[model samples]
Target chain A: MTEAVDDATLVQMFETMALVAATDDALRAAISAGSATLAYYSPRGQEAVAAGFAAALRPDDYLVTTYRGLHDQIAKGVPLRPLLAEMLGKAEGTGRGKGGPMHVSWPDVGLMLTTGVVGSGLPIAAGLAWAAARQGEGRVTVASFGDGATNIGAFHEAANLAAVWGLPVIFLCQNNGYGEHTAFADHLRVDHVAQRAAAYGMPGVTVDGNDPVAVHDAVSVAVARARAGEGPTLVEAVTYRLFGHVFGDRMTYVDPKELEAAWKREPVTRFRQTLVEWGLLSEADAAAIEERSATTAAATLAEVLELPEPGADEVLTDVVAPAGADATKRTARAATKVVVPDGSVEVSVRSAITLALDEALESDGRVVLLGEDISDSGVFGVTKGLAAKHGADRVRDTPISEQAIVGAAVGAALGGLRPVAEVMFMDFLGLCLDQLANHAAKLRYMSGGLTPVPMVLRTAVGGGLQVGAQHSQMLEAWLTHVPGLKVVVPSTPSDARGLMAACIADEDPCVFIEQVLLLSRKGVIDSTPIELGVADIKRPGADVTVVTYGRQVHQALAVADALTSKGVEVEVLDLRSLVPLDEAAVLESVGRTRRAVILHEAVVTGGFGAELAAGISEALFGRLVAPVLRVGALPAPLPYARGLERLALPGPERLLEALEWVMAYEG
Target chain B: MLLRLPKIGMEMTEAVLAGWLVDDGATVVKGQALYEMETDKVTNEIESPAAGRLRRIAQEGMTYQVGDPLAEIDED
Candidate 1:
């Protein structure tokens, strides 16, 4: 009515706000009556923020919101029946009863994500904006969070990255007076959330969240700037939560006077009275609107409460792409077509990797590369010349924001780009493990087959480089332990090239770890396409089996050759992929040899070798000639001195000792 | 003598003839940059293997498979 929109749009915003209020009241009442048993975050006073921003956006624009997003979800056009059904854990819900309240995602209504982690959705929203920018669709993405989220590192990383890339995204902060139990002043030092946007070189605006028209105008201006390719904007809408943070909270920490004042200025009441004063609606008409919203909310909840619960078998479904298909038992398949070259070329592992990335980028339009200094080919020169070859957009160089980089890659994958993001060192995964382990690894399973995050996080693991404790750890065991994430380690140049292509084409998220010690190792790379979860028998022998991967594979091969001179033939099995641990191949080789030794570069304590040894013993219990032994580095942080570094890792002598012990087993 | 498209990468099967550096019927020596072929987003300049009168058989902007004949050269 003021200036943002015509009378019809204002009425539409009021209608959305009314529906949100009616649903909130009905849900709270149901919880009080014991009809619903779930933890709920009440958005009683934030209806105007949701309604206003949603009114400013097109139905097709992407929206990433937080756990307190029932109002946002309804305003963004999520159907009342499914939204209510989800609240009751029904099978017909948006997430098929798997995501519950915190992890809900219904891409059909442009509600791309509802994250449970505080401030985690910001980086993912930036990634979605990147994809939209690439697709040349003027679709702007909105990331909705509370005032407290602005204090998190992800908020800064995402805002800066979005501004640097000129991405189309709006950071919508609903400053509802408190961050959970703590007041805003206690959590954040900034007076206004929007004021921090200046640090990221983006426009900052604070609006009256209680006035739907003001919010609409602010969001409209931000959306316009985004569509015009002016990059991201920070919009902080000031409001208050009328109730306690959660449904069951007694509000002992809140001041009685402040609570009462907030209730008097509740958004639904204020906006309704404003509409009446502006002559946009009569008192009877306003009453009818409220009546219609309440009736719809009640009817939907009643029907949803009767719906049956999700089947118990849903626990195993949608854990990875090709929903419900077991990755371990999946047939070895090539997702990318391979064209065998006429001849093999001798190249280093690094060069082979560059070739694989180049091939994927040239052949597949969806393939993209992003990492720190990747445009300069990274620290190892693996991605050298790629930025110039594929253009900066495809071979992107990101700031040292690991969380934002990986989160954005996950978001880009959801938006249909086969993004291959690189973390400079595998040890740096700690900085971004939440995005990798929580969001990227669980999005497919949490979305209940509604979303798939098909991206590759390539990292380097070095043990003998003497980079000390932080940068020289082989953390593959940590990654392999996580379900829904495929782990790939290439021992040869051919495997590196082939597996890189396969991982990019893979439908599930993958962690590709490159061993720094093998980057310059020369080998003949051929055009043979390799399928994931398949193991290669480098040397076939019967006396014993030496199972290894990465740089240790070469050491095992050398020991096998040396043992051949002593009349003991050792079989070397290289596991190119770790997660889908080629159980059949491991069993076949160990069963033949009747003796096995697992070798790896990681520490002996709790290394991936432990998993392999246990698995081998359990399967080949009585038939084995000797007990399986695991050879690995000493259980200590790798030292900076070369001698200490070499001492900690498995050397040729260690491999020979393990081989001879298995060969000389008397048990 | 015949010049054929060579495999660039282990995965490359076909490449686009981006452009010809030397015109048709131009005499070129061995190791001289002759034409541009693009594969896997990389553009490589193919050199003449032998000096001869070149006859451009493959047109510019056409894609050819590896080992496909691109041009014929009458040896000097």
Candidate 2:
């Protein structure tokens, strides 16, 4: 009941699959030999889908995949050396040793992004396709996921969006009969995952996943249709997972009889038999293919083993850009302060921010602001005048989609624009974390110094405005935890202006957190230059050092002044930046004062203050006269009531009390 | 030379000069606040451009066209 094709090309496809299987074996061997700590997701029996899709694709078409991407990547022309280097975490890896097995990417060859998360790559692929379509470049996006991802929200959302927009995207589902250890039948109700595509108003097709020719034909048609602006297609290729889910997954549920049938109908062997019968190639040719593949794999493994480790500076350079490029130089020069008249006048922080943006926009053509409700004076009037002055193109008003706002900014940055994306409130950062942490932070390093994303993320933090829990939150610690990101918290209007200017000028991605409570608080703002990693000493003392930042800086300064009157001589240090943190200043100040008190408005549990206290204890143990005391908000949700909120957050009085306790305590 | 406020709105044709900080012929630097004006929602200071002598054309409590010369600066 099936049509049989000729053997020659089928034999070649079989040979390629064999080679891929051998590479997977080599990866497992490399891991067992203790030469590498690799997480190998073997596509032992399910090789037809990869061979089919890869054969259909041109070198220019993009492929974004998930954790089980080894076969697809290799078949799509990724050299074994770099992939092995990545598995080994060597500098020569596809991701420069930063992304191990799961996060492999080859941007040059058009494999834009890859991930370990099951369905997250789908939306990203849709975005890339959208960009390519807007450029009219005729590049198609191929995103592959497993049967498990069929139920994920991102997969459906991406499918609906792609179909509705008629984007040039191909959604490939390699239904390997199992998601991890669970059988597909137990989880999915439908006989075919492709049948679900009708809901998105797109054509869906089911192919014989074990047959390379069938897969090739289906994918070629989908690719062509996508290129012709026909829309996206979901191709469900029925296959089986031959190996355990991971390196050591136990095969407890697999039936022996079913396994035997799967082995007998193995795609590589069946295709090879079909090829030999049709006289497409001789037996010797197939043997030669196997021999050549082994030799190539061995050579690649040797080359990767010889690659050197990444340097120390490599960890810090790629968050935005390194210091030599034209963009970097321009940013550095712009960061330097120009001579201007100064006076302490009454201006709200919101107004200062608007003025800074206006000045930056007028001064530089590359600077643009994008966000939701930004055109309508923003939520708190921070970007109130921008849209009217710069027009909608520069100050874009986006839909209520945080992910799209951040992702588009990343793409725009790659296209040579400095975008400052505002996420209204800090609490909403959770909605767009993938764009921030994964794409923007990792793109430069993953591309191996090829691309840099210079973007600024401006958001308001703290809880004193009675905007409720959803609006007011001090979530700077979450952003600071990620490497390659620069975190800044400015407490004064002058620092807000200067630091924002510096952030706009820097080549790295920066998260500028402005405390909402301090928007109305007034202070003397000296027009001094503020660098990214430098801490400012607000007051000099001897008994104890009170280290803090953001809204807590004012409280710490007041506490220091109050303690000074009592002859305690407490020093106050305001940490302007969180990442590339001024650890030296903290250590030096704590070492000199012999006692330290860390304060913050964020919750006490796992707050940045805990890290500071631990660092001081580790570095200045012998010099310290007492244990480092941490003063932070109570370990509970911030209350809405003014009095209750005051009780929850650390105030000047609390800092003074903590300083007194640290000053008198004998460890 | 004609002095005008940068394009701040699509429909705004004129703005009222609420107050002036410096007297006529006073030198001003770029980005220095020369006068204050009241918009629909808030009061904002209009900064000066170029270092020169400030010549006030519109007095306080008066309005002028968007691009009309509110003041003239004679470069040294």
**Best of the candidates, TM-score:** 1
lDDT by residue for model 1 over A332-441, one digit each (tens)?
43335433333565788998888888887877778899999999989899998888978999999898999999999988988879899999999999988888888888
The best candidate by lDDT is 1
Question: How many clashing residue pairs appear in each of the predictions shown?
Answer: 2, 2
Please state the CAPRI-style docking class of candidate 2. Answer: incorrect
Per-residue lDDT of candidate 2, residues A1-667 (tens digit): 1234344446656766877876876665443222444556777778888888877777888788888888888777787888888877888888788777787878667776667877777766766676666567788888889999998766776787678668788999999888877889998999999999998899899998888899988888888899898989999888888765765333567998888889888887777676667677567776677777767776677678678977776676555555444444334334223233257465666666676677677777778887888988887778887888887767877666676567656655654567898887889899888878887777777766555667889988758776667777788778778776888988777777767777777777889987887887654445565667788888888888889888788888776777667888878898988875999999889889999999988888888888898899999888888888888888878888988888887877788777888878877
Please list the C-alpha lDDT of all candidates, in the order they appear.
Answer: 0.86, 0.76
**Colliding residue pairs in candidate 1:** A377-A383, A377-A384
The ten-residue window of minimal lDDT in model 2 chain A covers: A332-341
TM-score against truth, every candidate:
0.86, 0.73
